[model samples]
Target: MAILELAIGFFVLAVLAGIFGARGVAGMSMEIARLLIIVFLILAIISLIL
Candidate 1:
């Protein structure tokens, strides 16, 4: 849940950065958001298995 929240936060930040014309920051934030979401999914699956 926390990881998902962080991913959402990063996605929001990416959108804001894109609106402000900070392409680099926006791209980085988007990548971080993607990574966080993947991590969250992996953790969720592991928790369910255990």
Candidate 2:
């Protein structure tokens, strides 16, 4: 699930980059990557705790 989201995020970023600009793509991709990392860590911790 997490991987899928991350993949989609990157795909969107790539498309946006080609259509719009590098800056927008970079910003969005960074944000998505950050969020994905956070979520992935949280899920890992929760699974370990349980």
Q: Highest TM-score: give the candidate number.
A: 1
Candidate 1 residue lDDT tens string, 1-47: 88999999999999999999999999999999999999999999999
List pairs with backbone clashes in candidate 2.
none
Candidate 2 segments whose C-alpha is farther than 4 A from its true place: 1-21
TM-scores of the models, in the given order? 0.93, 0.61
Report the C-alpha lDDT of model 2 over 1-50, residue by residue, as the tens digit.
Answer: 76658857776776677577687777777677777777777887899999
Relative to the true structure, candidate 2 reaches a TM of 0.61
* Total residue pair clashes for candidate 1: 0
Which residues of candidate 1, in runs, are more than 4 Å off? none
Judge candidate 2 against the unseen true structure and give its global Cα lDDT, from 0 to 1.
0.73
Question: What are the per-model numbers of colliding residue pairs?
Answer: 0, 0
Which candidate has the highest lDDT of all?
1
